[model samples]
Target: MTKVAVISANGRVGSLVVKELVERGYDVTGFGRKAQNTTVAQTYIQKDLFELTKADLAEFEVVVDAFGTFAPETLHLHVEVIKHLTALLAGTKTRLLIVGGAGSLYDDPEHKTQLVDTPDFPAEFYALAKAQTDALTELRKHDDVDWTFISPAADFQVDGKRTGKYILAGEELTLNDRGESIISYADYALAMADEIQNGDHIKERISVVGK
Candidate 1:
């Protein structure tokens, strides 16, 4: 069985990812700052993500960085966490899979503008979006660590239904049949689990959208 660890496993997306991995029969462990009444992980560790040492994660084959923050002041945590994880896994066999944002994806086919640069991008999420974008940029600089960044669609629906279907794309934002970029958290978790099993897009950034 493949061993997988999910950071921030108590969060919305992280929890779903943990559940999906568990359902798929992976030897999964979840890391969080506190214990939770409900969790799908076979093993749960209570520790601050930054406090984790390389030895602590040495046994896992893959690590999913599902950490997220919306607070204006803490938005920078996105990049910090990415840097920390990449640094920890550098020169190691463990693969780092990051939960990224769509803002960094190109808005046009010519690759001229990113979604974050478009006029219609949400102003409220600009900080978080930019931080995630910067996190991707930071991840790209680490060549020693094997990493894959997966960005959800523009409309990351918190309550959207799980269709168990999604489309994967490169750096450009992908739209469904209705000409919109959107994905439910459940479907995104499905895609994440599939990617973990496939390991096809190593050292690359991929996007997912609802079908």
Candidate 2:
């Protein structure tokens, strides 16, 4: 069985990724600050997200960095963990899969402005958004370990249903017929797991939107 470790496996998106991977028959391992409520993982490792070492991740074929933070002051944790993990996993076969935000997604095909650059962007999540975008910059600098960044649509619905269908795109934000950008976490997890198994978007950022 392929071993996969999901960092931040207890978070909203992380937990769904865990379930997705588990259902696919991968030997999934959950790593979090505390035990998760699911039985899908074969093992659960409780450790601070910042304190993790490569040795802790050496066993997995893929490492999903699903760690997320809402606190504005400590939003840097988003980039810090990416920096540390890429440094450790460099030159190894382990692929780094980052759970990215929509902030980094470009607003136009010219790629001049990002979604976060818009005036109507929510201020409450601005700090977190900036941190995630910076983290993408950090991922772009590394070529050692294989990496894939997956960004959700602007309206990420926490309570949305798992339609098991989503539109995949490059840097540009995708939208539905109503011209709204959205995707459910369940479908996002589905696409993410499919990416890990397919290896089609290595070292690139991909986006998912509702159909």
lDDT leader: 1
lDDT of 2 by residue, 79-99 (tens): 888889998899999999999
Task: List runs of model 2 lying over 4 Å from the truth.
Answer: 35-39
Off by over 4 Å in 1: none
Query: Clashing residue pairs, candidate 1?
Result: none
What is the per-residue lDDT of model 1 for residues 14-133, given as tens digits with 9 covering 90 to 100? 999999999989999999998672578999999899999999999999999999989898988988998789879999999999999989999889989999999988898899899999
Candidate 1 all-Cα RMSD: 0.9
lDDT of each: 0.93, 0.90
TM-score result, candidate 1: 0.98
Predict model 2's lDDT versus the native: 0.90
Clash list (residue pairs), candidate 2: none
lDDT of 2 at 187: 94
Q: Best by TM-score, which number?
A: 1
